[model samples]
Target: MNLELPLAELTALLLASVRAAAWLVVSPPFNSRTIPSALKALLSVAIALPVVPTLVGKVPQLDTAEMVVSLAEQVVLGAALGFLTSLLFSAVQAAGNLIDLFGGFSVAFAFDPLDASGSTGNGVFGRFYNVTAITLLFATGAHQLVLRGFTMSYKALPLDGAMSLHNLQHLLTNGLVEMFMAALQIAGPLIAVLFCADIGLGLLSRVAPALNAFALGFPVKILLTLGGAGLAMTMLPQAVSTVVDKAVTAVMQAIGS
Candidate 1:
């Protein structure tokens, strides 16, 4: 028995894998440090498998220079798609950061080993929210939906399509706006209470100088934040779902799908 492999399909699969590899390197929860790079590489190839047939016909002639250029394009395209997706999902972590800022927890910054960025300056709530969001993504099977969205990108962008910088810029700007707004929505009520608490403490300080209201402020705000965070956690499942949908939408829009 002899086995035959079509060169065009092989080239297409390799190109598709390159794109998926770049995306996996940048997107979460696949991008988390807990996931080994080797696993990511395998997963990328797996992800590109279904798209291979669609891409085979689109595969351009691959001389050395064209191959290099094509490989670079795939990386950029995949990274841009992943970045847009990540930007939408970052809203949850951003909300936690805002909570930490308002709740006086920012002072206790420590390293989050699970974070892809390997940043050592995240506060307690920020890391908590990020971890929880990732867990929810897997538990609810939203990661599959995210993968489905990426696979759909080939139809819109294709292997030979050139990405539009102007459109990418527009989507990027909108993603940022949406990210900030989403973060505010999640942390807003808590922030408002904290703000009121601050104002009350200021008033109390002015009225009764003998009693250091500022001293009480820390404990009071901490209690409120804890309570608020507990309540806010109940909303995470829904928020994660919404973010997943938004992430998919952002990816499709980025590729003009």
Candidate 2:
């Protein structure tokens, strides 16, 4: 028994799946190793289904250099879009890193088993923020926006669209810049408080040599970090809302423009 789809439909599915698979391979939540490849393939198919009809007319014939080039193009396009989707999450992680740095918890970083990258700053503040941010991501329905953006990207950048690898360097540069700016915006207040704590400790050290201000630095800073951490955590739900709004805009602008 031979079950077969029409060649045109099959081609559309494969190409669309390739793009979807490439995106899932790189993008977060889906990028986690705990997600099985079979599930990923199924999700790819599910995603590809809606977009296949739009690509039917544009399906490039699979032959010679043209096919290879087109395959590469699909992969590149998926990766770029995936990177765009991940930018704001990187900012969240960066904010965590900043909190860790200022709180003197940089020394506490350990190999995170849950981290696919194997390296992560598992500082108290950053880890807590990461957990809460992820919780808010699901609770606020931001994941739906992410999936919407994924599907919407194809309309903005078609399967056969031109992609210049040269632009990749610029994308990365801009993403990093945005990451730092967003991190500062999220963690800037707590960081400033920590800075003021440092200054106060320095002044107190000069006032009483035997007071052991340097010895108090760790506990005082930890207290300060914990004290303001709740306020910073509260900002995350709103930040997640803002980030999701901006993320969709970024996705559209990145692909559409």
Candidate 3:
């Protein structure tokens, strides 16, 4: 056997793998540093396997400047989709970050390499929320939805579809607004409670200037936060499901669908 057919097949598979792997590089749960590079590469190949057969006659020639431009476009497309997915997913973490802000946990910063951008102290609620969101992503099959949305891009977007700037701007603007809205929805109740606590502490300080209200405020807020966290648990899975669904939609929109 000359291995000629096998070589062409491998080439196609590798090209498809580029898009898949590039997507995972910035998409959450997959983008985590805890997962080894080797594992990510394997996962990329695994995901691309199904797409490879469908890509017949569509692989671009590697010998021209046009091909280089096309490959660059593919990378950009994958990165854009991945980033949009991640932005929505971060809503959960944003809620948690909000909690940290008022819970007096802001000063407890530590390094978390898995976090793409954030201080250590900023993740108190964010870390817990992220872990729960990731769990829900798998348990509720949202991960599958996200992957399907991405895989479907081969048809909806095509290897050579021209990107529309207006569509890209529209998706990004809407996505940012949605992200902050989700964050506030998740964290607002707790923030309101904390605000009440602060007001109460302020009144107490006025009534008893001898007492250290500032010192008492910290423990009281911590207790409230812990309690609020338990109450928030019931809302987490559902909120995560909604966010993941929106992420899939955003990914589709990112590809101009």
Q: What would the TM-scores of all predictions be? A: 0.93, 0.88, 0.91
lDDT string for model 1 (36-149, tens) is 989999998999988888898889887998889999999999999899899999999999999999999986764445554645567899989999999999998999999999
Cα lDDT tens digits for candidate 2, 1-257: 99876777788788888888998888765776768999998999999998888888878877878778877888878878787767767778778878889998766655455564637546756767766777788777787887788888677777777655556566667777877888899999999999999999999999997999999999999998888877888788887777777667666666755
Each model's Cα RMSD: 2.6, 2.8, 2.7
* Candidate number that wins on lDDT, 1 or 2: 1
- In model 2, residue pairs whose N, Cα or C atoms come closer than 3 Å (at least 3 residues apart or on different chains), thus clashing, are none
Top-scoring candidate (TM-score): 1
The total number of steric clashes, by the backbone 3 Å criterion, in model 1 comes to 0
Q: Whole-model lDDT, candidate 2? A: 0.79
Greater TM-score among 2 and 3 belongs to 3
Inter-residue clash pairs, candidate 3: 109-121, 110-120
User: How well does candidate 2 score on lDDT at residue 156?
Assistant: 70
Q: Which portions of model 1 show Cα errors greater than 4 Å?
A: 1-5, 110-118
Q: Rank all candidate structures by their TM-score, best first, as comma-separated numbers.
A: 1, 3, 2
Question: Looking at candidate 1, what is the lDDT of residue 83?
Answer: 91
Worst ten in a row by lDDT for model 3: 111-120
TM-score of model 3 vs. true structure: 0.91
Higher-TM-score candidate among 1 and 3? 1
